[model samples]
Target chain A: MKNKLLVATRKGLIVFQRDAVSKWKVIGAHFNGIPVSMVYEDPRDGNWWVSLDHGHWGIKLHKSNDKGKTWEEVEAPKYPEGTLVKEGVDATLRYIWAFAAPSSDGSNSLLIGTEPGGLFRLNIQTSESKLNQSLWNHPSRTDQWFGGGRDYPGIHSIVLDPRNDQHMYVGISVAGVFETQDGGNSWMPKNKGLKAEFLPNPDAEIGHDPHILLASSKQPDYMWQQNHCGIYRTENGGDQWIDVSDRDGEAYFGFALAMDDEYPERAWVAPAQSDEIRVPIDQKLCICRTEDGGKNWNTLNSGLPQSYAYDIIYRHCLINQQDELFFGTTTGNLFYSSDGGDHWEALHQFLPMVYCLTWAD
Target chain B: MPKVSFTKALKRFYPTLENKIYIKGDNISEILDGIEEKHPGIKDYIVEENGQLRKHVNIFCGEDPIDDRITLSDMVGEEDEVFIIQALSGG
Candidate 1:
């Protein structure tokens, strides 16, 4: 099991370690008092990368070669000059929403998803970054894709097929899902079965909001997403998506999702009350788990707040490494589960508003 | 030459950042370039990729705020004091 946890919070990047007694405690904190948008560990080289959102200074990227001991600021991805989100809006790096390292062994490249719906490929060795023109120049982006929560559409999820480095999928708010089978040279919209209730045509080819997207590492073809309207699953590499939301239960709307790597039939979601009310379901905090591919959902709330709770989990806040699961909330609460979603224990309740959570060796 | 000063908050990143220094430039844009040469990567915090002042960043030429945020065409007098500050914002 991973023994260290990295919590990217609104105030800083915090590190927690499991002690000899198996208790998690704060081990270190970096970028104090600065909003950390994302903390990513490059799986290929174990390098720590952090994205900072300086309200006045613009966005920045930093990397640590020696764990969290030292850090050096690197070039944050930049949208090319004259690139426009629309007719006159010059595109810029508003936010670094997602980071993915190439699955191919010893590759010195990283993929970044940003606001204004630009995907960047960064060469780590030379620190040179370029926007993926194919995705940026997609036909529907300029006219059809608009902002959801942010002022501009953002790419927040990048899932690379572990079996094939060339195949990948990106999740964009208000723009739906796009798949690239040839290393991002081109992309095709994969929202065949998604519903955009806000649009005049709910079954339009694009403009579906997928809050978070995940794929089972063991079964790469099986994918799942916690969408704005409901929950969905794809069994055949996103050829078609099946709506599996619990209509009568408290599992219809949420932003965070986690999938079992070895079991394609199992998944988990932290459901909010609804899209309009961004809080725990019924004022109770619980994690809904599905053992039979979303056919049924079990509410797991043991050791969690039972009533009057108002914690909301962000898309990247819920993560799992085998049976050990961890999630941090926007309310600054962090919880850990040793045995899947059967139970949870509050690790810390007073950190900064947690943005994302990840584990390190 | 105009003397350029920065917000103390920047010292966290550029520990060796001097509170103030004289830079040779005729306009805000050229002055920023001179600052970047002295302290690498500091200019990005003040401006964006399009060379426009960040939304929440402000620059003052003596007691007057810079006029052209996009082109930064505001000229800096040789004896003027250029102050770069982070606008008070966010919770």
Candidate 2:
């Protein structure tokens, strides 16, 4: 399994290296112009966290122990000093978006997902870097969360619980789906039966937006979500949720989700244009598989791009493993499908708006 | 000594921060404490964890904008330049 790929672009962090005759190389760009939102690598030691975002120095968390070659500036997820702001929200800790890599069981325990919406937890195996806020002041985060086109509200999907490393899971765009057995110390709102037409009470526990949250590393209670309004599932882990968006007439809102760490009834989504014109639904460019999880759906668009092709796909940019699924697009296009989505390839073209796609070893 | 400089949007987040930095201060808060003692956290992106002066960060000094942004003292000159700048948060 020697494919590296780490694409997290909006300007910076793009390392790709396939080679073994598959040929895909571009291991350079790292922090170049800086707006990376996610990039994690720490298979245990290769150390590299890098989740920066500086529309003007708002969030910065870097660390690269030889992988990106050199870097250090690590204490980044804030909110500890007086910390208590909920009336119209303003505690300021903008943008981290995601990072759930830790749990070799040695419990170096790192799990972040921030941006006006918080959930930090960093341990770093101990060298005096302890972070641990455990869902920050999360009593539904005051007056019940909200924000999706930015004004603060982010924690774009972070799932951990291969089998209960304290069992935690989070995905909050407008705030929905949150769980913690003990690791995060008290929290619950599994978003029961999830759906939020934009809310007037489309079943709300806390705002509901979740635009990507997949946890089923081979069915750890089966879960999958991609919701601004549709596409959801949760067999048990989340307690209750099951919209399973096939949309019947096709195009179920869409943000990007990928399960199948080894097929827990496989999954993958990529439909755009839920209206406000987000791109590629009727403009045609697809990748909508569901080998029985969401009750059948298959529209993997042969080699994709059937028409004018607008494309957006950005919720950590759709990643997969066992049969390799990878994705990238905001118009900078970089697709892949080593047999999981069934057949596709368009390695690179233009290359910049991807946002986040992972796969390290 | 006092040169200072910065703006290139503060190199996004201190991409080595070197637009010009001479050092040895004599005001402007000792040249921002000698450029934050040689760039360690770059004065929290131009001041305001409480140090104040981040009303969209301005500094200047050689031409004038540093109106004692919280006792910056404003005096410098070894061939003073200063500058700093901020306002340009996202296009």
Candidate 3:
């Protein structure tokens, strides 16, 4: 028997297979160009969707039906009636940063997040020529950006309820979070406690832009947000949020956050560009875990070095299987923990920036 | 005046765009020129440097393909709908 670990990386996509003995081997490379975002395998089937944009390949939609064996491309996706799409000045690259698949809601759907925070949806899995509709296309969003630029709120993260796919939310680079209750029909702002530190006021009702987001059916309201200012969570489903880290006594800005596959509330996260350089700036890497929900958190830096370690991690660069939580540091360190957050092991010393970590069993 | 509509996916960057009039052209060239009269630079995105349809760009008549030989004049009509899709290409 064998299992696979699928990853979308800067070097392209690679599938790592685990044999009967659990020895990992590089099974395949699906694309050569830069695959900025991708899905390993959908629970529905081996159907995979990858978004890549590297050097004139522009932005692309790649599909694999046979467990990363072969691939197909959908040049254009079908849209609903009256859904008029504007053209881009720069046709060189249309970046698709994130994608969300169907959840346990029994509603089979897909959400693609692109640069400039353009949101589109595939309501049903009919055919390549029939993917339809815009989940949330704010008419005045482009003009309402906080910093007032194109790079604002590109929608890098689309978080779906593992239990109910219809109930979902997305985090924008600068605009913040938007939630949708009816699958992909419409959306509304769910940023109550969010605080965009970059704004003129840090305690404002609006503008706590989110860069990355993670959601689990078990913790529906407890989605994690890796923001430009700091790490936050919405315990009431984007209504109110709280800071997961208290850096007053410890370093806390974060970009990477991972939750347990089996238990959504249990999570592990790391610090990165978020640190304002005043949070102790400890190079000794640390992984913080929260078991009883985000009520409390503790650092699991036992097997880790005693000092001098700082390698920021990306939002999707971490994963957890049961109690085995793993995180990849920009320092090229892949750390693994078995006792939740108490003990740890450095799986391999070097592996690029270690952009992502995933497992199959 | 009969007009052609662009999809929301296309309207993203070009927000000012909605439904455009078909400049009195019988052939694909004339129709594009007509569109250019109303909106400039859009024909450039639809056509190519050599005037060939860009590989990723496709124009459809109902559900049929529209190309140089079978220009808009042959396929497009007041009764028929035209859809121009710029392939949303990605990984």
- Candidate 1 on A1-361: residue-level lDDT in tens? 7889999999999999999999999999999999999999988888999999998898999999889999999999988888999988899889999999987847688999999899999999888899999999999999889899999999999999999979999999979999999999999999989888889999999999999989987898999999998999999989999999998997789999999989977889999998888989888999999999999999999989988999999999999988889999999999999999898999999988999999897
Q: What is candidate 3's TM-score against the reference?
A: 0.69
Interface RMSD, candidates in the order listed: 0.7, 8.6, 11.3
Chain A TM-score of each candidate structure, as shown: 0.98, 0.36, 0.81
Instruction: Summarize candidate 2's per-residue lDDT along A213-317 as a digit string, tens digits.
Output: 887766777888878787888778888888877776454887888887667667888888674788887788888888888887888888877899987888779
DockQ for candidate 2, C-alpha atoms: 0.05
Q: Give per-model TM-scores.
A: 0.99, 0.35, 0.69
Error of 3 at A327 (Å): 2.3
**Best-matching candidate per DockQ:** 1
- Sort order, TM-score high to low: 1, 3, 2
lDDT of 3 by residue, A1-361 (tens): 1266666665567666666665556677766445445454555544777765543224567777777677775543323333333433222224566766665534355667765456666544554333223433465454444332344346677777766777778777667788888875777777777667676777654466675787766666767776766667766887887776656523256667777655766777775434456221456667777776666777667997766766666666777666756676666666666677688777656555554555543
Give me the candidate number with maximum lDDT: 1
Instruction: Go through the candidates in order and give the C-alpha RMSD of each one to the true structure.
Output: 0.9, 18.6, 10.4
Any runs in candidate 1 off by more than 4 Å, and if so which?
Answer: none
- Candidates, DockQ: 0.88, 0.05, 0.04
Residue A311 alpha-carbon offset, candidate 3, angstroms: 2.4
